[model samples]
Target chain A: MSRIQSVLQALKGQGRKALIPYITAGDPHPDRTVELMHTLVEAGADIIELGVPFSDPMADGPVIQLACERALEHGTSLRQVLEMVKTFRSRDDKTAIVLMGYLNPVEAMGYEAFSDAAKAAGVDGVLTVDLPPEEAEDVAPLFAERGLDPIFLLAPTTTEDRIRAISQHSSGYIYYVSLKGVTGSAQLDVDDVAEKVSRIHALTSVPVGVGFGIRNAETAAAVGRVSDGVIVGSVLVDTIAKNQDDIEALKSSLVNLLKPMREALDELAS
Target chain B: MSVKLTEEMLRALPDTRGHFGAYGGRFVSETLMDSLMQLETEYLKLRDNPEFQATFDKDLADYVGRPSPLYFAERLTRETGGAQIWLKREDLNHTGAHKVNNTIGQALLASFLGKKRVIAETGAGQHGVATATVCARLGLECHVFMGSEDVKRQSLNVYRMKLLGAEVHAVESGTKTLKDAMNEAMRDWVTNVDETFYIIGTVAGPHPYPMLVRDFQAVIGRETRRQSLEQAGRLPDALVACVGGGSNAIGLFYPFLTDESVAMYGVEAGGLGLSSGQHAAPLCAGRPGVLHGNRTYLMEDENGQIAGTHSVSAGLDYPGVGPEHSWLKDVGRAQYVSVTDDEALDGFRKLTRVEGIMPALESAHAVAYATKLAASMDKDQMVVINVSGRGDKDIHTIAQLDGIEI
Candidate 1:
């Protein structure tokens, strides 16, 4: 089975939800990034989403926005993020690693080259926030050939037709945004999200992971009850922003924050 | 009397990464990386050289006419029923705009960098004219990239640039507008990084650029500050200016950002209305992203694709803003708002009739905002507006709008 499938299967057997924490690679300090990645994995993160910081990130909220600014300040590029991933994979292989960001950095690196480099670095999947299903057609197959799942976001505003289109093109899993606005806005209706997930599940066999407003343990638990997985970004990004200067403190805080939701998912699964 | 720069102030200007408080830094492609580094090194060397400073200062005073008048607009004040209004007559500067202030500075810097040719991209053609003028004065080879649509609409500017011995290339790719022109210019710069100097028209773009442009344009505020003290015996209560890529606005706003009592207003172009989706109000409608170098607010789609923006004034039709302006907006140091195209047109006509001033459509946005703002405020307050450029080139456009051939 693929790395993503293995993670999903492990979750099913344990009757627990996967905790995915996202941190922009090379933020604050690149040297400590690999250590932070390992720390996050050990801290109960089932999957680690390493954000390749782009010069432009339209979908990100303020928390991730600041993180990107910090990362870009150090002259971090796609090459640096890929090298960091290579360093990360050298230590851990079982933890499913996904590279998440906009398409500019990848476009700047070219598709074939980026996919080849990513696979070499042990990246398991790719989730470009700006690459829609139609555009994904050009790059998705190349990634699949290299064993990298191309993830697509299914928004609340995404029509049924588009959802079907996204599902047909999507690999690994589907990312369902819970709100209308960008990542950090507050209003998230659990019932509305559950209904959207059910609608998506009806069309696709792949697991649906809901994100974009699942900030805390309660929301994660609530979303986890219906959805296959809960993807927490802004909150984890906020944590990294608050403790970026102190990596140890950031790791501990992230672990503590994810432990409750992970435990909550266990209770629901059982 | 001369104002000498103290060591502390000069050191405080450029930040650790060569920024002016989150405003400047080099964000570039690998092709021009070495060129930028060399330019940065040369710029640093020439900045402290006495010969360069003397030439720059002398040109500002004699040619561009330093210490531009701070005339109080008594009639406009009485009509608006607001504070006493004062105008910094940068529009009276040679080349008919404030763009000359930075063009002259960069032209000199280009020469110092041993660059044989100067290249620039223009939207409203103000910067093109300014750069061409300087290139003529300095005997440098000049090339300008303008959007094809702009070349057609702003034909007079194209002729003027050519007359100044500058080659004008009309870009037809993408939107065939300012942003596309900028991309084309960058591509050229990358191709000819060794022999050419890219003269950015606005306070946007990657690193030292935002800081460099602001420094060159700061002459407006510096002169305004001195002239205000001379004419009004004090600084004004508020300052108003138009923001395209925010060069003129930043030029006027930077000196006043630290002045708590001087309210700074940057008027963005609302082409039709905010709801019409035809505006260039980046701060209002855009989110923070990286484009054209430094991180700033930009108008982009969900997939982070840079969207083509709309503005009646070609100068204001950009997807992103200067990084410093973004930082200022975030800190609430200045207020950024929008004025619609109709309102700008009204202001343009009103200024022509009342003040005998044919203001550029870009500058009219500020005038429109100022007109509305003045009507609501108390008479005791004082306001200073940066009359950034002239509207002579816009006569044809204005005539076309009125269904009359110019």
Candidate 2:
């Protein structure tokens, strides 16, 4: 089994929800990404979502957008991000890392090359923000051949037919955007998310991880009740934005913010 | 050598998923998929309905002043002393630009879809003004997204859109240009999909949009074909049009795809020069990548980040071109070239002084290329250029560049 599937399956067997934290690769600085990934794992992240910074992140709200800008300013590329993942793998092998971003960089690198490079770098999965099922038919198989789980997004506006199609092709986990708008949008209704996530779960066997609009422990706990995983993004990036000048403070604050959510999610599982 | 494309074959392109030969597809977020699919279905139904066609036709004839003259440029011809030059005067259309053609068609579609609000993104404001005008006429709320830098440069257009009862939002995102405005507009559409209809002003974006915009603007080429047969006694040997998102160029080139004898040329904005790295000439210097929901040639770095693009003309300051243009370029059906800012300026001045017609800076790129092309061709051959917009909106920019206040 792939790393993501093994990790998710193990978590399911333990009756505990997966905690996934998303941070833009090379944000603040390129050298600090490996350290942050380890910190996220230490803070109870079962699957680490490392964002490949894009110039235009349409699916993201202001917090992640600013993170991307910071990462780009520091000269972060898809290749550099893979190198960071490779460095992270040098000491650790249990934490599953998923590279999340838009599809242009992958297209630029070509599918076969990217899949091979990702597998070599120990990337367990990939979530392309703009690539829907209709566009993923060509690249999905390439990823599967490399044993990389092709993750997809399910939103409030996604239709049942589309959910069926997306879920059929997706593996590892499905990211259910908790709100109708972009990431960091405020108005995450826990009841709405619960309803949609259940519907998604009925259609596919892949674990559903709720993301977008998850800001704190309460929301994470609420989502963890209805989901197989709770994925946090903007809050962690927002914390980094605040402590950009102090790397030590940024790492500490990220851990501080994630720990409560981890405990809360664990409590629900228990 | 290019294959002879039939009218029927060309019209049947962009099969169901909106793929224009591996270029165009619906690459949007899942939230916007249902809306786009609904739009495509609605468009297919309305595209063949006679009543819908009649209304669009009526609007083009009565409201937009169709059949804009195909005038022979006697002075420009004499100066070049090669190909006989003709101008398809799209500048004569309502709003003084070809952008109104697509806006009118989309506004009608929006009304037919029962959408209460209409949103558009613009760079030069001609499209924003045209969209606002149609929304005011149709009694729908209108909003236009523009780059903050464009808002500062084209303040007059911003005021014009507001005066026409549209909300003008200045997008402060990446590079603060047309691409950023489009990104913001897409975000807004995803949030308010039920009530809002996004009227993309160019022949780019996701599927159906490129095909739809090209269909709306094809009136230019259709009219030119008839007018050329009447005045020149034959189809012009060559066709030239400026390309930003490639609306005007594709509009003029679509109807002539089967005309194997007619050569086509698309002019891109060369801000300074090809080597300067500060230009919007993607077809000439950039590579293909997925951006703004389509696979097209874009000004991007090795890491696939969209590069900062520059152009003297606000309308042509985009980092990517339409996917159809990309297909056309790869198929050798058309040749893409670039014109420097100074050369386009000279074309602007020459046309005003010689033919007594002022052209927009965006259109001036075609004019500049036409001059160079005309000088190299035989005198007996004929060339027709789509004068996509008038120069009134660009006076402030021209004056500023000339070191004078308006």
Candidate 3:
């Protein structure tokens, strides 16, 4: 099994939910990313979703859009992001890392080259936000050949038939968008997402992790009750945005915010 | 002579999954797949229903002033010094552009779908004004997103859209142009999928949009076919139109795709030169990639990030073209070229002085090429150029260029 499967299965075996934190790879400063990745793992982050910035991030709301702008201001390329992964892998090899990005950059790098590079850099999964299953027919298999988990998203608006179709190509886990609209745009309704998650579980064996608008520990706990993993974005990126100048304070702020969520998920297991 | 194509090839494209050969599949986040599927189902049903199509037609005829004149440009023909040249006066449409043709159809569909609000994104502001005008007529709420740069550039059309009562939003992200406006509009549509309809300004975007907008705008080619025969005793030997997202060119070219005797030319904006990496001629100078929901020819860098596009005409200043245009280019069905900012400006001045027709800067690109094309043909042959819009909105840009504070 891949690193992603091994980690998620271990969490399920322990009856504890996984905590996934998303951060743009080159945000605040390019040199700070690998250290940040290590920091997140130290703060009880079960998995890391590293955003590779694209010029136009269609699925992102304003907060993450600004994050992209800041990341790109330093001339962060896809190759540089993979290098960061390599750097992070040098120190830690246990925590699963998923590269999250749009399609054009991957297409620019060519599918075979990207898959090879990503796998060599110790990437466990890839979640291309803009590449739905219909377009991933060729790409998913290429990624699979390199032993990388091809992750896909299922939204509340997705029909059951599409859910089944998307699940067939997905490995590792399916990122379930809890609300409509772009990322970080709406309030999450736990009951509704719970109902949808149950329906999805009825169809596919792939685990579902809930994300989009899981902005705080309360929301994360609420979502953890219904999902295999809880994803926290926008809020953490917002924190980084607020504390760009002070690296020590930024790491401290991330730890203080994320520790409670870890405690909350543990409390649920108890 | 054109390559022989089957009738099926002409009628059947974008397959069921929205692929045009290797291009034009729906590549979007999962949040939008269901909505796009819903739209496709509705459009498929509405396209064949006689009443729905009839309503669309009556609105086109009565509201949008269809059957716009196909005038013989005698002076322009004489100046070009070769073949007879004619102008398809899309400039005389209700909104002073061919953009209304598609907007009217989409607005009617919105009404049929029981949508209460309509949204659109624009660059030069013609499409926004066109969308706002149709929404005003149908009594639906209207919202238009335009990039801040375009808002400042096309202030006149911006005022026109506001006067028509649309809620105009100035998109301030990602190069601050048509692409950003489109990104914002998609956000709004996904946010309000149940109550609102997105009337795409061009034959771009996701699957059904390209097909839907093309069908609405096909009236231009249909009329040109009839008018060419009526006025010139034969089908025109050549067709020319400016291409941004390629709505107008596709509109005029779709019906004539089966006419193997006729040639088609699509003019793209060449801001400085292709070598300078400062132009917006995607089909002419760039490579194919997925952007704004479909796979198409796009101006992108080595890293696949969309590049900043420059053009004298705001409407042509976009990074990507319609997916079908990409397919057309690959199939050898259409020839795509570029005109410099200076050449387009000369075409704008020449048409205004000779024919008393002040063409939009976007359309002027076509005029610049059509004159050279006409000069290369025999006097007995005819060329039809789509004057896609009027120049009333561009007078200020021209005046500023001339250093006259008009």
Give the per-residue lDDT of model 2 (tens digit) for B340-388: 9999999999999999999999999999999899989999999999999
Candidate 3's DockQ is 0.85
TM-score of each: 0.62, 0.98, 0.99
Candidate 1 lDDT over B156-241, as tens digits, reads: 99999999999999986657788777867876775456688999999987667887899889988988887877877888888899
Q: What is the Cα-based lDDT of residue B158 in candidate 2?
A: 93
Candidate 3 overall Cα lDDT vs. reference?
Answer: 0.92
Compute the lDDT of residue B52 as modeled in candidate 3: 92
Instruction: Give residue A22's lDDT in candidate 3 (0 to 100).
Output: 95
- Candidate 2 TM-score, true structure as reference: 0.98
Candidate 2: where are CA atoms >4 Å away?
none
Clashes of 1: 4
